[model samples]
Target: MAMNGETKTKAKSNLSKRGSKALTPFSPYIDAVNQAKSCQWSPSNEEGFFLMATAESVLSFDLVHEKIRTCREVPATVGLYGNFRGGDRLRSAIAKMMERTFMGVEVNSAHICISSGVTAVLDLFFFATCDPGDGCLIPAPYFPAFDNDMSIRNEVQPIPVQPADTHTYIPTAEEMEKAVVEAAKRGVKPRVLLITNPGNPLGTLYPEATLKELLLWAVNRGLHVLSDEIYANSKFGSSPDEFISMEKVAQNAVLENLLSAELVAEFVHTAYGMSKDFGMNGFRVGSLHTRSKDLLNFWQNMGMFAAVSNDTQHALAVMLEDENFVDSYVSENKRRLKKSYELLTTNFKTANLHFMSACAAMFCWLDLRSVLAESTFKAESELWKEILEECHIVLTPGEACHYGEPGFFRVCYASMPPNQLQVACDRLTAFIEKKRRKRKAANIS
Candidate 1:
């Protein structure tokens, strides 16, 4: 389906200037993703593609679906126009769930705004807080789609703060400072610092001490802090008390006089959703919890475009209101996550592949440096292609995640059954062994 020269010219002319720059007509990563979708691995399909690239957990989806099914029927008002900021029933349920589950403090429903998804929540957040060309400082080895989330419409620039040691993933205070200076040089004003708790792809949770320090640092620099806690309830392989919400950290910081209450109210915000924690990505439900009256005012004027459907809101509200079901569901979800993570890591160890041990998110940062032909990003891209095209296993390349180095990839284990995971491991290990043998023969020659 190659386009002729004239056809290509016609297609290019059809697109708007901004649309042409933002859209991709051809991408190897996207091609692999489409292939994975068409041949997804299942029990009957032994030759199917292994989709380990996306951050989706199908482990406890049955529980979530059942809860949604049994929840109260959608209201008649759903047929009519609903509140732009979200219904009181759903927002109140979310506020209470925050207290009962993770936040450890009461949240005011009035301060919460419901949106179609976290993607939209962040889009509106940036629109309200920053002007065009303003930058948000995000750490390297972070979520790749954030480029789309921050930029596609809002025109907010993402300035990556890379760590001194690429393996650490988290950038140091000095590194962040340097990023701000560099952003200024590029004429991008640094307006926000985004922290992904239970780090995406890395799956490492920030310690309470480190969280406090980062919050204080942001406040001192007059940067708004947006903590995306979408995976808050997904922390496994640890005590429940080990997982702390950003709101709790902000409150404690204020109590300790490290941050002013006014500053914390205006600057600190949280984004949460049903996608990761509840295995309800299809629900398309996300919320923004902020104490800023300015943000709420902005939403009042422009929130209708991103509001969640009334029926979907009601169903999720009922699900959250059932405290017993919510409690048991969370416990079982974590157990399944822990089991899947252990299985994946055991296979990695058996294959002599190095990985950073993860406790929260569904992904593991896998190192394939030993199998690379050279220490370059180009080599990394080639390895990714080989694994996908030859081994039939789809993994996200480190380059896509903006990681500072090569030979690393994100492996999502919770997206498949254990049996399929074992098959994937066998294929991957076999590929690695063949590469090693060829390297040995080449060295001897």
Candidate 2:
């Protein structure tokens, strides 16, 4: 092993100045994603099943071919870097979809910017609005992926707007302002307020009144408002307080002069994506809309870092332009999700696992407090570990979603087939029974 006279080894080199930030370890969300990938289903791994850990739309569709119907002129896009503010045709279609299908008002295509995904758009959006060390006010029971997306590279932190109580984890407008003030006290400048309409972990829709109140709270503080409307067309609920579009609300405020046009232009920005709504996760296309001209021009110049691939743009352009086809596809997707949700809820109820019935997205935010060994997050982690190890199924721990409570988990109802979802429910019920039996044994002793 001596290298004195035989061979000399080269010395190690130093990493760059930003290496600490760049080469830093992956966040917990990345850990979950990796675990899901490793335990994903295949013939060999079929005995060990994958319960949904990540939120994705159901894949039992026969209409994927409908998305990319043509290659006649798609190759023409491959040679160029394309527009930084996104291509006109695709932007126009997105605008139209918002106007006709989801939002009530027409969107200006010039204000839309297309990127590889919502995370990329958020990165650019935050960079445009926030400085290093600044934060965005995010309500708890929020999406976990946002923790790193906000700051992992940009140094912008996600300041959680925690609820007063754990059971009903809804933050009021006052809570939003209080969170901003709290962040300011801690020297973290709150630059924006981010809300997931048809919320990710909660799976509930925000009412218009609640939306307006939060808008006033942010406007009073002069903070930008980022409404993630990625689940716009996923609504299948019968409730009167259904999905409400932020852009539509903004447009109305402008028309009625309740809020000044200048303020609307300066403060409001909306994000939407294809991955969830259209079930085109692989396409990696997302859109952001704003009324600010300065921000639009800034993206036009520098957005090449994560611009959508031209072929994807072309393929989506064709699909989104077909109003009738888009309408039918959206309707069918909702119908299927509603059916799956019903089955999941039925099983959960039969097992006495109380869960919040949702209006949108693929998850059921489960309340597992009754079965917890102790009313603490540590005990919740132990329960989750047991299920993941013994049941051979993955479930998202509420702690990962920044939940204020200790005993909650998000179980996706749309990621797998209906029959498989039934199996997942059976396995969960068995876990609950096992825990109950253990508790009874301890009591007897």
TM-score of each: 0.95, 0.92
How do the residues 1-445 of candidate 2 rate in per-residue lDDT, one tens digit apiece?
A: 1111112223443765445454533334344445556556544666555657777776435675645655236666567877877888889988888778777777888889999889889989988899999999998888877876788767798988787865556678888878877888889998999989878987788888878878877876799999998988888878558688887777677788778889988899899999887887777888898988888988887689889877778878878888888898888888888888999898888888889878788888998888888899888888777777666567788887877679888888787878778777787888888888898999999
Give per-residue CA lDDT, model 1, range 1-445, as digits (tens).
1111011223455677767756652234756676577877777986678888888889999898887898859779878877788889999999888778888877999988999889899999989888989999998788878877888778899887777875555566777888989889999998999999888988888878767877888878999999998988888886323778888999998899888889999999999888998988888999989999999888877889898889999999999999999899999999999998998899889878899878998999999998888999999988987887788888889888888789999999998877778888888888988998999999999
Write down the lDDT that model 1 would get: 0.85
Q: Considering summed lDDT, which 10 consecutive residues are worst modelled in model 2? A: 1-10
Candidate 1 is scored at a TM of 0.95
- Lowest summed lDDT over 10 consecutive residues: which window, candidate 1? 1-10
- Candidate maximizing TM-score: 1
Residue 389 CA displacement from its true place in model 1, Å: 0.7
Instruction: Please give the lDDT score at residue 147 for candidate 1.
Output: 79
